[model samples]
Structures are given as C-alpha cells and as structure tokens.
Target: MSTPQGGSSGGKVRGWCPDAWRPMMAGDGLLVRVKPRLGRLTPAQAVGLGEAAVAHGSGSLDVTRRANLQIRGVTEAAWPDLLDRLLALGLVDADGGREGRRNILVSPDWKPGDDTHRIAAALHDRLGELPALPGKVGFVIDAGAEPALSAESGDFRIERGSEGVLLLRAEGRAVGVPLGHGAEVEALIDLAHWFAKSGGAAAGRMGRHAAPLPDWARGSVQPAQPKAAPAPGQRELGTAYGLPFGRLKAPTLIQLAQTPGITGIRTTPWRILLTEGGMPGQLDGLSLDPNEPLLRVDACPGMPECPQSSVETRMLARRLAPHVVGRLHVSGCAKGCAHSGVADVVLTGRRGAYDLSLGQRAGAPPLRAGLDIDSLIAHFGAV
Candidate 1:
C-alpha cells in the first residue's frame, strides 16, 4: 500500500461522491468508493476488496456513513487497474449510470428471501427505468419486522407500517403510503418520476425539497417502531463489531474475511459490521465494547489526508472523546463529511484552528473560534 504523498490540493468540497468509474481527487491521491450489493459481501469478495485496497490505493478503507466502502490514496495511473479488478470481482455495476442510480441501503438483518432482500433485488433490476436523480438521493429498505434504519440517511424509505404492511415514505415526511405486496418497485419508480417532474432536482435532496407530496404519497399509517442500533457483541445471526471512527485497515479486513465459520458480512451505516455465522474470535482491530466512548465520536481524515482540512482531527477527537459527553463531531471543515447531521458538540477546523459550536451541525456558527488543540483539551478537561 502506498503512503499518502500530500500535495498542494485545495481544500474544497466536491458535492458528489466517487464511483468505480469516476474517482475524486484529494490531498493524498484519489478516492474510489465501492457500493456493495445490498452492502453484502461474500468472504471471497471481501478478501478481494482488501487485496485491491492494498494493491491499488492506500492500505486503509473507510466504512462510510452510507454503509459503503472507500479505497483511498490511489494515483490516477492506478485507478483503471483497480476498476478492472473490482469489475472482475463482481463488486461494481457494469453501467456506471445505473450503478449511480442504485444507491439503495438495505437492512443488514435481512434473511435469504425476505422483503428487504427481494425488494432490494427488484430495485436493482429496475434501476434503468427510473429517472435521473440528484447524486445524493438514495433509498433505504428497512422492511424488517421493525425498522432498524430509521436514523440512517436516505431520501426515501420502504418500511413496515403499523399493521405489518409495507409502506413507501418520502424522506422528510413523518408518515407514508402503504404499497401492495407486489408493487413496491413500480411505486418507487413512479415516485422518482414524480420527484423529477415536480422540480426536486433543484433542491438536491428529498428532505430539502419544498413541494408537497401528492395525495397518493401521503398517509397517516405510521411506520413500525425502530429497533435499537446494534451494539458490538454476539448477535443471533452473527457477531457485531464496530470500526473505530468508521475505518478498517487492509490487514484487519483480510483477517476478518478469512476467519473461520464466517459465511458472509453485512455492513451498516453506524460503523458496524455483522459477520454472519461467525463467533467473536481474535478480532484484533475492532471494538467489542458497546460503551466505548470513541464510538460516539465522528472525525474525518483531517489535515494532509483530506485536502479540505485545515487541521489534524482524529487524534484530537480521541483525546477529547472520554472527556466530553454525548455525540461529538470533529469536522476537518465546514462540510462535515464525517457526520453531516446535528451533533451535541461540533468543532469545525478553519485556518489551522478550531471553532467550537454546541448542539448544532458543523457548518453552523461557532460560539468560539481560533482555539488550538491544547486549548480544546483544556476546555474539555474542565467538562
């Protein structure tokens, strides 16, 4: 794996993410994000991904908030070879356009032929029929007995209703319309067209769009209760492990992929992975304690690793993790790629200094500014 050779890359926010066909430039090199099929990976595919990460980019992988995997530090020269390897492993979409459109997040708890699995497969097959959407628009299929992905990010959600009926929900709405058993995908396609025709593209996100949903798309049928976020430990289906700060090294991934009794792996947006049918054995770099404070913190690859960052982040976050309470987001910049949602404590980096904010997202105005790492540690130490 190549180490990051920092360059004079400008600190700017690129509105979209990188796919297998198109990568994004950063301070270290280029970044290629892989959206797995329903975030499911066979052991062989997982091993291949780790190998590719080591061979073509940096030896590190990021488990993104969208439950995708990112290979960082790739040079322009290495991207084509990496893309070929990914395609051969059956981990990429043959058509980049369809791949970009198929940004569906599945419930990791799905069984072999369950609603989550079937609906996601059907959506994948029907991707070509949907209209072009904003790059960040996505769907979440949490059709488990209870919705487990409510807090995760997505523009549209397919979840169980109060009476076990499947409902299709617009993102910002509190309720959703129930769908017939066989019509989930078709209804979804209709909604996509509705969004496009209603001028949703300008808003860029379903939640942000101002237009009211049509009568057919609105209902009072509340979604079923949400399940608790999975903690790091043994679960009925497998063992759950947390990636500290949502990152895993190539060696650790390869080890987990090769572990005995592991049938497959499921990724979640909460920095957790479920190793199906596997026991908690020798997990060298993963967190097993649910109460680990660092798990509550979100920090990006700040400074030299990310061109947009003005200061180093993870280390400072670590130092403050235990000292602070509630959810903390140490953003490298105002973009807050690490955690876009509101956090209890937010520290935005600017001009090699930190700006402190409380109970807000990263871009919100800070209560104080220009503090150094030592000052932050001192401030948190008092808390």
Candidate 2:
C-alpha cells in the first residue's frame, strides 16, 4: 500500500502555505475537518473548535470557503472519539459520509431563530440517506442578509422573494420551484440528486449550466426583492490582511477571539476572513481594512507544494495584486482550484510562465501569452 507523504506507518500529512509556498506539516498523525452548520457557530462552538484543534490535532483550525472548519494532525485512533465529541456538540448530526456532500453556503448574517436552519437540517438529513449523490453537490440558503458570500455563487440557492414567495434556483438560474416557507428546500434537493444520478458532468457549481423550465412557467414569476441595504456607518469587512497566504498564526487567531464585541468571524470560500465587528481601536496597528486590494485577491498553491504546479502563482499574483480591480483569482493551472465562480481577472499558470484571462469563465482562452511576473503586472497595469 502507498503510504501518505510525511507520515510514518500512520497517515501523518503535510500541507503548503498560501499559494503553495513553504512546507507546513502536522505534528499529529491525522487531518480531520469540521463543517460548521450554516456558517454560524455559537461562542461555545468557537471555544470548542479552538480546544479541539489544540488537543486532538494541531493547535490550529482552518475556516474553509464552504463555511466549514478543518482540524489538522488527527490520529486514526482519535477519529471516533473526535467525531463523538463533535456530534455531542450538536455540530455533527448530518447523514453518514454525507458531511462533505452537504456543501451549503448560507448568508453570513443569518439570525439565530430563522427558519433557514430548519430547512437546512431537513436537506442535510435527506442528503445523508442518498449516498449516490456526488460529494461536491452543494445547497445554499440565503435570507438576503448582508455580507452575502454564497448567494449568487452557490449550486442550489433559496432566496427570499417578495413577501410570501421564496425563489429557488438550480445552477444560478431560476428553476420555477417557487414555494412558501420550507416547501422548496426539499424540492431543490430532489432536483440536485436527479442531476447527480443522471450522469450530468460535474460542473463543480450549479450556475455552470442552464436550467430549463416549461413553456407555461416562463415569465410568470416576478423578480426577487432588492436586497436590504447596509445601514449607515456600516461597511462590509474584506478578508485580505489576516495573514500572508491564507494561514493565520495561532496567537493571532487567539487574539482575534479575545477581542470584545466581535459579533463573529465569517469565512469565505475564497480563503478570506471577515470580522463582523468594525475594526477595533486596539486592532488599529494591524494593517486591515474592508477594501484593501489584497483582501479582494485569491491564489492557489503552486510549485513546491503541488507537484503539478509549473510556476509560483501566489507570489506572482501578490506582485500583480496592486494593479487589478474588483475581484481577481490566480490558479496554478487550468484546473482553477482557488475560485468557484467567474472572476474579474484570472491568471493561470502554464509551462514556466503565466496566462491571463478576463471575465468569469475558467475554461475560456487566455487573453495574453504566458508571461513572467513583472511583465504580467505591467500588461494588466497598462489595461
């Protein structure tokens, strides 16, 4: 049998830093990931996650773009016990082996008593029973709250429509599966399972394909209500400066936890972090803002970390970050692993160089030839 890299007889593993830089290995013998329900973990859950990291695996936890938490360095022996603990914490009651398949991204500001959680729980239970569904099948439920991350980008989405209707979408297109309250949630799941078992190519996201509706259903539904505007003096915090390359040091994370009045931490799929509270006066020293260019940039690991990477994409992207606008994503290869949706700018690594593409489609042809880091920056800057 093939042993995992960096592990003895056990399954010890190692991972790369941001954009696949320096090597970082887990001291423990296992890597265990925790998926947060609806991206809302209570203060108790936060403390539990921190403790789980320090005791079972590494003293660190990674918040993934899917609104989940990952605990590295787990040992095989500790797996059952850890799962038991997590389940007891009310965070692990979903379907068997269905945790990964329940990739739902809800609004960051989802309230505590909203019906969205009830609907998510039902969908998760249903998904658990259907093991045949692809592991990447995802569902997102948005309440039209602020700091919306997965609303537009989710594979299956449920957004508020008018006062009584709830809009349902499959692959970012309206599916005409309108219903009241929790009615459409299960319908959305059935639609996803149908697509998965029908041998439809894994689009990796729902919006990648078009959803066809019956002729009678066309143009009958009204447009969804406009999302509520953010209040005055309120700004959405961007996830740019928490750390270099997406990993924050343990001490810094602890310090962030200790800050008072911090409603919570919101993690995005782009490997960025957002603080619900405004930049605290005490945190003024840290170079952070809701609109920094670095916060809007994303890159995948390249070169040393991923054996398939041909060039150092993260460093190259960082060097070019200052010249881009809106949101930019840099991938190590054509696979485009870092981003799930259309990016304003995409820099994909090629044979010892880079290729740039504009617009959101990943497979689109490059706009320019593979160029070096400096030349790439200059070219984008000129545009």
Candidate 3:
C-alpha cells in the first residue's frame, strides 16, 4: 500500500516514460517500467518477475498500453537490487539507452519465423544503429497474416500491405513505401535518420511533425485489414485473461506462471495476457469475461500512487462502472495516461475535484466542474 505525500507529485508533465533504468517518480515512490523482448516471457521468467515485484517494490504491476510491464511502489534504495534481479532474469535490456530507444511494439500473436516475428527480431538487433527521437515516438511491427496492432499507438509502421507486400509507413501519412524482402530494417533506420535530421525532434512525435515524407518513401498500397482485438477466452495460441485497469498482484502472477503446461506468456496492449499452452481456468484478481464492465472503463492510478493527481480514481471508477452506459474514463489528471482517445464520458481530476465531460477526452471542455465524489457518483447514476 502507498502512503500519501500530499500536494502535487511534482514533475514535468509527460515528456519521458519510465523504463528500467530511468524510472519516473510517482506518489508511490518510483515506477519501474520493463519492456519484454519481443513482448514475450518464458514461464520461468514470469515467475521470476513476480518474485522480483514482491521482493523489490510494490507487490503489484501494471500492464501498459505499449505492451510493457511496470513494477510499482519501488523505493530508491531498492531499485539497484531490483535492476540486478531483472538482469539475472533476462527480462530487461542490459543497456538502458538502447532499451529506451527501442520503442518497438510487435504483434503479440506473431508466429515464429513469420514476418512479424522476423522483422521484430531484426529491429531489436539493430536498435543501436537508429538515431535518437522523442521518447513517445515508437514503431509497430504488424506484418503478420492480418494486422492486429493497427489500432495501437505508433509513429512508424511496418505492416503487410495489400497482396502481402511489406510496406513502411510514417504515422500521419495515409500510405507507405514498399520494401524488398529483408530490406525492412534498412528502410526503418533510414527513416529514423531522416526524422532526426529534418527537425522532427521539435514536434516530439512523427505524427505531429509537419514536414512531408521523402518522395522515395511514398507508395499506393493500403495495409491489410486489421483483425479483431483479442478477448478473454481460449485462442488458437493459448488462453487469454483480462486485467481490470491493467493491474494484478504478485501472487496472482506467480500462480499464473506456475500453472501446469504453461510454457510462455505474451502481453498485449489491450490489458490482456496470453498464457501459452495453458487451459482456461478461474484465477482470482483477473477477469475472463469479454463483456466485463470494468474492462470497458479506463482508470489511472490516482491520489496516493500518482504524483500529478489530486483525486483518488480507481475506487470511484469501480463504483461508477456499472452505472455508466458507455465507455468511461476516470483520468487522474488532464494528461489522461490511461486512455488518450475519446470516451463516452471522461471524468478528469482537477484541483482535487472532478470535472465531467461527455463524448470527449479528459482535456475537453467539461459538462460540469468541481463536483465532489458523492455528487459525481450521483450524476453518473442518474445518467
């Protein structure tokens, strides 16, 4: 459990994200984010991570939208030991800078030796060759049979174009440049160098940059159709389970890792975890229902956990989840880290009070402002 420090969490608003070496200070000590290589974990690695979480920081973890994991509530003193443990488990990149710059998201459903898998592996190996860009800027490898990560956030994309051709695309652009077989990484590195040299760093993200893509990087092929988002249930690859607000306790993780016949674990951006080779079964502190109301809602760790927040979030979100009719977002602050996209109803925390918005995101003009928790609950209950 986290003890409150009172006042603001006191940090710049949203410049860099937390990584294993450079962790962000939250209300709950520090938040250490870990990026799994290829978004995968052996069953032993999963158990090791669970134990590390219990031994080093808060006995809880957060599954990020980037398909990464965060160990919460770590004190400054414990971070060194925790990092050593992570290195031993082979869960984090040895070089922090390389890990930070390798902001690549691969399709979790990728098969071995498939386009997604091979490209992802190649990119990981060549990350050191790429120039530095903004921390939030990232790449996606969705060159699978069907694009599953198309809707996820990314500034650069490698996807299967129409008729199964491989294409590299900038995020804001509608089309991409076709690549010859095995030339994917070379094109990606060249694009990164271009972005770095062309004043794209000022914009902080490729999609936000105004400069036009190079002429050679243009193509007419549309990407393959995106597959449906994975849901909690059995899949051809494994059994999937959803985490409410992308959070789970250490013991639960240990239990999942120790399940018989489970050989690996795959993390997805949708708050779902795939237990490779495991059968469907009940697990406490996890949801198996696709239609679970809490799954539809997004809430950040507020109050005592996040330094930027003034109000407690998840508890109120839980109480209001069933009462709301559509997608609900209870953001700790205007940044809306939990969900950047629009929601049916967005409740943003401001000056320790709640501001309500309908059919908008957290920063949009609110329908009502400064409502206390009880009144906020009543307002949603009446809706």
Per-model TM-score, in order, reads 0.95, 0.71, 0.95
Clashing pairs in 1: none
lDDT of each: 0.88, 0.56, 0.87
Off by over 4 Å in 1: 1-10
* Model 3 pairs in collision: 9-307
The ten-residue window of minimal lDDT in model 2 covers 15-24
Weakest ten-residue segment in model 1 by summed lDDT: 1-10
lDDT of 3 by residue, 1-383 (tens): 12322112455565878788777778777788889888998988899999999998889999999999999988877888988899899988888779788688999998899888999999999999989888888889999878898788898899988778899989888778789999998889899899999999999988888998888787888888889988899998989999999998888989998999898999999999998898888998788898898998899998978878989999999999988889999998999999989999899999999999999999788999998898987777743
Clash-forming residue pairs, model 2 = 19-301, 20-301, 30-74, 65-268, 65-269, 155-206, 171-206, 171-207, 240-295, 342-360
For candidate 1, report its TM-score: 0.95
Give the lowest summed-lDDT range of ten residues in model 3: 1-10
Q: Give the TM-score of candidate 2.
A: 0.71
Between prediction 1 and prediction 2, the one with superior lDDT is 1
lDDT of 2 by residue, 229-252 (tens): 222123454223343345444445
Off by over 4 Å in 3: 1-9
Clashes of 3: 1
Q: Sorted on lDDT, highest at the top, how do the candidates line up?
A: 1, 3, 2
